[model samples]
Target chain A: MTGRMIQRIAPDALAQLSAGRSTVLVSGTNGKSTTTAMIVAALGGAVATNTTGANMPGGVIEAYSRSRARVAVMEVDELYVPAIGASTLPEIFVALNLSRDQMDRMHEVGSVARRWSGYLDGSEVHVIANATDPNIVAAVGTRSATWVDPGWAWRQDSVVCPRCTEVLMWESARWSCVCGLRQPVADYTVEGDVVHTLHGGSLRLELSLPGAVNLGNAAFAIAVAQRRGVDSDLAARRISAIDDVEGRYGTIQVGGRTARTLLAKNPAGWASLLPMLADDDVLIVSINADEVDGLDTSWLWDVPFEELAGRTVGAHGVHRSDVALRLEVAGALPVVDADIHRLAGRLPQGPCVIAATYGSFETLRGRR
Target chain B: MTNRLTIAHVFPALLGTYGDAGNVSVLRYRAEVRGIRVSIVDVLPGDPVPATADLYVIGGGEDAQEMRATELLRADSGLSMAVHRGAPVLAVCAGMQILGEWFTDGSDSRVAGLGLLDLRTDRRSVRAVGDVIADTTGVLDLPTLIGFENHRGATSLGADARPLARVLHGIGNGAAEPVEGALQGSVIGTYLHGPVLALNPALADYLLTQVVGDLAPMDDVRAEEFRANRFQRARA
Candidate 1:
């Protein structure tokens, strides 16, 4: 309702309102909301952001209209980054890893990377990019930017070089293509719990968010904060206080069982989050095919569900049958139940880990 | 001893855009359930196409990646020889476009395809993306083929090609003619990428039978239920 009304009332309002403010646009397949929230918290002092997960243009306008802050940090959708970049003239643009996401609605990963490359070429915005992802390296490698190697786990989208189409050569910590494209030397690198800078200084990050991916997100957020002259230690302290971002990685009680809801939207996200689960964890995988969920469940095959081969699993949501079939093929018998509360009741004792898509996660999070 | 069936997944890294790799998983799962031994060989770019495989599968990709995949596939005569030797091939979306005579690239320039099928593809102004229901009754002997269609290519078939199905719901080829995909000899190509084989088990079985001869049918209640649910959702 708010988005439509804002769209109708002032179609050009975003361009007008963002004319004088210095903006930072955060975009990627995953971690946009969390990273943007971390940046907002780290910057402190009247920083405006789209906390409602409305990263689109209208939502951005509504967010800006609601705040009187001069500095704005906004999460822009990957596909809409070019348009938003044009209108916002952002001071800093953070490029996270690119991967296949919502195949039903999104363009292939290569096309999106190429679009980002076109926008970044000859532009004055300072780009903070992931050096580990070959797609990101190919996108913004030529331009001078602050590259960070937070490490990438999902190689399916980066197996073939985006520039030369040759198979990339993968080594222990870096990857390179025979055509001379390679992961850039990082201006900032994450080593264990500490982030090392090239200038012989480092910040030990203590992130409250779970998973190595969140640490990587914090590393990027710290880099952005450092560029803005915010104290690195102060930024790390601020980021560590954020335990949850927009209901992600939050514990909720349902049907007398405690569960931590983790949002795994794509193959890359699943690759990062699945390893955090223990062998005996009660796993509930939920899926939905609504407009936000992309209406296609074929990506389930790409995920390494075989890791849960010996575990007891529960499948819930509109696409429970699809999830059940995937799990069954992966050598696990899954109980298919559409009711979340009922599924929660059947979970084994101890804390459960619930991995869900966008719609399923939102529905369960709303119940809290 | 059970006879082992070898399936070649072509350029999975380049051509797997829309969970299209799920098609290979469905084939393997269905085959394993029926007590048939299966071996999957992933053929990456620059790798030699294993011509001895019983079946070949390729999925969708981005335009640039598709063009590169077509170039690599055309350079290797092994796939063409395998197709000539009667190995069944399943190609989806961008893969389907690359198996044709030619397709439009990013600059609207025509790039040559493998020419295994008598078809050509050109980009349309508007992309056709939504739920698709096709009537494959006579062709594949399936009830109602259900899947999701997302493509911008307007493919036209020649005399040597016949459509695998007729579009009953969404746009198929995005052309004035209402055909879905082209089928030539043992080669099948379509834009339906619910990883089409997962939703249409009969089609997977048909491709399997083409290699292993007539086989007894196993219970496909789960596949049937999945199809029914998707069909109902498409209607809704």
Candidate 2:
């Protein structure tokens, strides 16, 4: 496989290849691929990036090797951020919100935050972090960084203060701990489709990506681009051009039916994506418990699947029964079908929303 | 008349790291299938722990949140009184670690547990993470239990405690004793975090039987399929 070859040939290739490039490292539990694409689009000048979600160090090396660009924007996996950051010495490091993702393979949220804190401590690298996420604030510490409050949606992983281990108080759109640690004041604030920056004043960002999470990603990407000397309005306009970031929010024609593919890997992702579903939307949830997908489907219980109670639900993929069971328990009647293509054909003739995990999403994307 | 059963999910916002909240859902669903009226009370941090619930369920969480949950649970005299009154409890992973007498963090600092179970957990250099298949011969009336285990703490049971299962496949308890979890009185603790009960229906029925005595068995095709899939994946 190409990955194995890349691992063997150039284990430390990422460092050497990205030496002279103005690298922007984007790392997060979700929206890494989309954010990376948005940043690359905003830069618009000979930027090389891992647009297909191969986000490990080797992937970064491969992306750099395949391109003749002087500027590199790569999506780094959250666990690999420290190692890659140390190697690439990125000009801009973006720390997005931290939440529970792939628990079987990934470190706990607190552990990840601690690792980030250790990596960022006293480092001179300019960092962009989320101000609303307590974990990100704790990780960034006193590091000189541009903090932005795009709005915090998933609070389960950030309820406990990372510094004091005390339950944080959430009020007035901000989180404050009893131990005196609180959400930092943002240099850039995202309020209702507008990004308000400290220096450039306010710029209205009309992003093509749906959901408040995507808007947050756009705000961070535009801030990073602006800091790198890109015009703020131009950056926003370029980011808005990205309607689909590698199959996300894109339409796939399968079995004579066109389905909109949306990816929800973990409970937090599902919490954000499920609300975007329309009331009459025909929903197809595909789950796979492969090695890449964490092999644990218990998080299905944590998702508010009851939101799909009135919708016609169809479960597809390797863990179709598991998805059906969770939906059934949540008061929805889900029809289980292992064959996704066949399931697509059997669905009523209408626009259907396909929510899938990482592996399943890739399979659907490949089909497209 | 449907027998009423109340299940308290303790600190789900804090102690729900590995989808362990599914364990509570499994218990509620299994109970409802047996013609029992189920009511779930989510006891969050700063909320008063209900003194009387038929069952109490706690899930896994991060080390910091686990320590915080232990502190809050220890302060709740109502939970202690409920355990004293023979209420059944199911705790998983970090929840199991905190239900014990004490848990030591990675930095060798120790925090006192709820003292509901006579067990102690110490951090280990190697975090045991993978698929786990345990022999629940004596603990539950099931031949084999399937789940996933991801933890760093090596738990040891005292004289008054017994292991809920033997580690048949993965490294559980992180001890040379070949044990998985501890069982004391009506409390069950385990590191298996496939929402263990969801993959093993008999285990859910066993916990329900502790409260309502004998229970009718329902068709468990989905549970059996889940167990088979997990076993296959574990072997692969």
Candidate number with greatest lDDT: 1
Give a tens-digit lDDT track for model 1, residues A69-155: 999999998888988888888999998889988877785788888898898885789999899888888888677889988854578
Q: What lDDT score belongs to each candidate, Candidate 1 first? A: 0.86, 0.84
Q: Write the per-residue lDDT of candidate 2 for residues B1-236, one digit (tens) a residue.
A: 33889999999988988888888878888888888988999998999889988899989988888888988988888778888998999999998888889999867999899888999999988888888888978676476888888899899999888998888788989876988888899898999887788887788888888888789878777677767777887887
Q: After best superposition, candidate 2 residue A356: deviation in angstroms?
A: 1.5
Off by over 4 Å in 2: A1-12
Query: What TM-score does prediction 1 earn?
Result: 0.95
Task: Give the least accurate 10-residue stretch of model 1 chain A, judged by summed lDDT.
Answer: A1-10
